[model samples]
Target: MADPMHDAPRASITGRALHVFAFPSLLIAACLTGFLPAAPAFAKKPPPPVLTAAAAAVPDSYSAAAAKEIFAEGGNAVDAAVAIAFTLAVTYPDAGNIGGGGFMTLYVDNKPYFLDYREVAPQGATKEMYLDDKGNVEPDASLVGYRAVGVPGTVDGMWEAQKRFGKLKWKQVLAPAIKYASDGFVVQPWLQKRHDYAARSFAGKTNFDVYFSGLKAGATFRQPELAETLKRIASDGGREFYEGRTADLISTAMYGHGLVSKQDLQRYHAVWRDPLTADWNGYQIVTAPPPSSGGVGLIQLLKMKADLKPAFDGVQLNSVPYIHLVSQMEDRVFADRQQYLGDPDSYKIPVAKLLDDSYLASRAAEVKADAAPGATGVKPGLGDTMPERAQTTHFSVVDQWGNAVSNTYTLNGPFGAGVVVDGAGFLLNDEMDDFVTKPGTTNQFGVTGDEVNTIAPGRRPLSSMAPTILLKDGNVALVIGTPGGSRIFTTIFQVMTDLFDFGMAPQDALAAMRFHHQLIPPTTIFYEPYAPITGDLADALKAKGYKLEGQPFNGDVQMVRVNGTTPEADSDPRGAGVGAVFPLSPSK
Candidate 1:
């Protein structure tokens, strides 16, 4: 099989410039050559053709192409999203998997719905599960091995979304993924790098050799076991994986690791809830609710900036003052996240009080224009009651019928738990690491949490996966999300600012340099390696008493911007993904 990474369409400068430069160039050339038409008056040329069938942005080329194919086959946004999710399970294994779980925000018929399929702790789980006999937090207890695995919800989540709004048969949606797993697909560089890293880190612990043996960039990789597993799912629906043989296999494997039991598998269920929404600059922003700190955090950050004028005064987007302001807001929001956000099902979260205008105003009042706030000193707002990886995958889909789906799924950390089920051919999530094992102590990602997010029996771990949809005048305006652990909400927030405030197109918005500040350690700002804010900008920030630390990359956002019936999509340039706008059929 050919490597889709090589064959996928690349974003071109000329293609983007066609609408802005082509017509002007033609008229200029005609006038220069004395061939300008005398009878015909020049009028503005029509804009480029809009993609009418569907526009999809995904974390992998194969998955994006698979979604496009589903749309071509008459599937709606939900159907295309289902196929893309499954295909990512095969192609983007570091994060996408049937063994993990996530949240989805679907917009259909002008109504939005939220689905929470986040992994839950087994019934045997307890607040002290990750603590050592000496009462100290055991690092490995919740970060690796079978004990770290949570009851997965990806299959059920996708199943529910498809069953509710899909226009194609479930089997049809699973077909592409099944073929990719059985027949094999060319290994892309990103997957190959993950394979190499796993081989080194999970040496002797996992069966990396079994599935990814001889894995190399541009080489064909196949997983027949996974193929059979997908076939069973296709034939029996999601029950086979959740309640039947597959579940039994998972239970037996987990039991050997002393993590979960068959009963745990039988009791797992996905929840359907009202999406958290807020009005932002005349647009309705809808996102996943609790169990996801993303929605609330995003809203709070945006709200804080609502009353403030642009820091750079429209001169530069990534100026020192602008970056400092954004970073300050992030520190405050994350402080609130650590202290308050958690699973509303397990705790009483003050969602209403947190979003109150008065509360937000007080929080925003703490910001200083000339100086960066001390991160550790920043405190959460006093609410009546309260309320939250770098490893995850997000995809956005918009179909011809105006239906849209924004989904973000993950296995917690990359190749979570660093262990794959023996026969299941899927990696289990280490979502237990997401809990507040020891308050005040930072997790692997340098993020801290409080009692609100502590572990408990049947409690879902909090996440930073923000699957968001922007609506203007009750119509879908934007579909966007990303996979960046603590950086997810921040990344999406920056992109939104770029599009709405800076007036950038989708591609430029995603391509812009990004930075992240989690607020736990304070004093340090993690910026992308080649981020725009450097040199004089870096010096300016330093003068303001901020420490700038450069990191490899931050987030990979997949987004689609809607203009009436047309949708333009773009995948993050920081990652090796593809964005495709499927051609409209003649009948449409």
Candidate 2:
């Protein structure tokens, strides 16, 4: 099944740009070979979403190109997804990773699947792992060193997805990433800000400057060590990362500074659990479940929003009343989030009771048109709670065969724990910070947690990564997800409502103004600076006792939807990413 140019095993890189190899040029200067018209930038607001047949929408163009390559070789959505995931590790190290872990939602063989590959606490982990002798939380103790890392699961997750439904050989699917890691890819100008930020924040705590110094914009960024690691994984499958040489490197790198060890790595495995699916407004909704509070929160928001104004029938998009109404739904959910959700295997998550119609109705009945109940106003009805990270990435893929995959993965922070394995060349996740390091404390994203989600040996932390798929009748309607820590499910709820209920085009919905409110700090509201609320609307919310602030950006969503059986997708314009469709057509 190899292309003629790939018939022989050979490659050569010329300087920092040109290359003479089958897969080399694909990751070079022109990475969007199958991409459509240029996606809008965050500078502009309400850019319409563009949908095309057999598409892939990702956080970076190189990753999109990798998906395109796999599709060209007759790979299914899952195969293309594997290609995208690994390619991201090479091209978008901040989020796309093999060293971290996340969740996945898939539509295969007319059914739904949810994969929980979230990282887990080490065997040595304890509830007070990040607390000091005085019972105070240690600053950056769970966010900036080897002690921050948990056992990673991305490798096993990807392998499980491929093993169950992928059509291409595992080695074949991993080739593009290996090639990119070995030959290097053109560094986009957009990465400079985040690159600079990482250097400054991690100056003394990590080896970031030593390992990532070459990430200057417009350069050929290569990771030979990472390529070698990928080669071993490709040759031996997922076990290579969990039990072979890569595991040894990770354990040695941690030595006396971290809790992860060879034993922790060997015990890691991805889980295939039933997806959370529901029917609302004639659409079948499917999303991530328990260890992740996303699906539950999403459904609750949808249910609460459904009860408001009878229907979204006359609600103007972003109108004062609309923002007020949606904020009410959001503010109530945090109480539930902080009380009744955590890893199903470690703690009992009251999923069914929390999602029961009677329960949601009771929660919905409490929503009011006035301002939020101020900080500490809401409480868990049934009781319990959890937290997680924000520097994450999401991608949506739909192959020509009606197979779709929506995935979101992260490193707990940009570049993860800031610790890159010396010989491995990948970042380790600070996912341990996702747990309740101390009761009633907030993590990097400022979401408060309780003991229900406390650290435990081998337990997966609570998460808000909501990779989701929606279906109309029996056909796929939408595949979507994003990264915003506490802002995730709320943002996803708004976008999906825009597409289905408000009739906003895909890009407009993706690029539209975004606003967020969390119960931890109930009086403050954060909206994206790009597409913001600065006029009477701001005054209106102010009149309602809300203090508004502008964040540099909002959620960067990667979304795909069906248009009468044809696939279409658009990456968030607020991000430096791309949306592409294979078999390009002039009309598109």
Candidate 3:
């Protein structure tokens, strides 16, 4: 048999008609018959471990390096976080920097602290300030005018946090931003998108041509002006940005462009707010409270879920009850937000009563198990709030020394106010509209504007910046936050559950599918990553009497988690982020 097979194989088709025909036919038959083990079905090789070492970082390279260096230099998480913030101001500008204002949350030695460095209204602002001749509110025009800008407080907040929780000196922490701004930094893809968004606002403005040209994709833009500003802050501290030469320039620029007055700049102040907290399986999760609705709204939603314990206990992620419960809870939270939440300073918002378990339980009873909620359905008493129609940014840092920082920043709408301070190379925040422009008028999040959020002289605008921290056994367990105006609460909520409850790694948690609902639109927005389960969820939600709209994943979340020994960091891949660990060592 072997001799016969070998002799047959030795035959070659070389010119003879029959031999050539037979050889060609045999080749064709072989191809068609598929006798060969079609590209051996082999198991896909696993991808190389991204979190190769115990220490990890989120995506942004500059930010990752910034955090790493701070930790390497003996700074704890707070110091590194502060350093990363300054570095982000230089590296990521569309978000809040010294020029803009927002909020920060700190977890230090098992305690939670919130810093409210939100912008303040001008001296002359009033409820009807944005009203036109016909008494119609002009939010766009108002936001574009100097009157739209509020007193910036981000610098003060950052410095104040450093004073209390940071280990490294302010200058040492800010040195990275100054160098990046002075030397130049690569304008990443995300920055390019933001630059383009802000570019139209800067058209025909002074220095527009000089500064924006270099912001094109792949361009290395050097912000020497910002570097100088950082230098001044480094020397004189945050006061320079508020009451010093920088303030004067900012004021002059605003005044020249029909924007805010100098009084607003001098009057800016950052407040230390009492953190709102809720218990989840014995772990204390702390977040920002009003003038931001992040804390209250999150609590309301979580409280609703607390009663539905069985949904979270299951192993498989795709359960009908689980999906329905999460969606309904989200809707209820947004509904409450639209009706009652506002600036606690002006509005008589009974936050204590709102977050009360009994109150939330009553609201949970309103969610009908079988249908989409109507606007009139599921109301949260007298002070429901809505998220502003805006975009924002976020960053998180943890140094080796037990100090951690979570911050969320924004300019309200894109290229806030479309007003730029001449020669300052910074954008002013249009945070004024964060106030309710008119009673009963709808703001970004479809919430009814009321007296509480109505504009007033020297009132800080309401925000949704919810930087959060979680403590386990009296130690920092997680530092997390996101950059999505109305969707902020949902993003953070999901990450918390994913990390603490589900025990997912930071990267896996971040990469997981996400959904957002604010109750205004009465529809759930599902991200693409949820595609696999979309049909099933749709059916499940429908069976529960809910309508849904699948949407692309829209928020960027950066998170850090501690698992016994080594800490881990994961930035959303959907964002222009880079996650890395300290010391750059291999995984354990």
User: Which of candidates 1 and 3 reaches a greater lDDT?
Assistant: 1
Tens-digit lDDT string for candidate 1 (181-206): 98888988778787787667667765
Model 1 scores a C-alpha lDDT of 0.79
For candidate 2, what is the TM-score?
0.88
Pairwise TM-score winner, candidates 1 and 3:
1
Write down the lDDT of every candidate, Cα atoms only. 0.79, 0.80, 0.66
Over 26-70, each residue of candidate 2 has an lDDT whose tens digit, in order, gives 432221121111112112122222334578889988888898888
Candidate 1 stretches greater than 4 Å from native: 1-51, 310-315, 383-390, 530-533, 585-588
Q: After superposition, how far is residue 374 of candidate 3 from its true place, in Å?
A: 2.6
Each model's TM-score? 0.88, 0.88, 0.82
For model 2, the superposed segments whose C-alpha errors exceed 4 Å read 1-53, 311-315, 370-376, 383-390, 584-588
Q: What's the distance in Å from true for residue 529, model 3?
A: 8.0
For model 1, state the Cα shift of residue 470 in Å: 0.4
Least accurate stretch of 10 residues (summed lDDT) in model 2? 32-41
Q: Measure candidate 1: CA RMSD.
A: 14.0
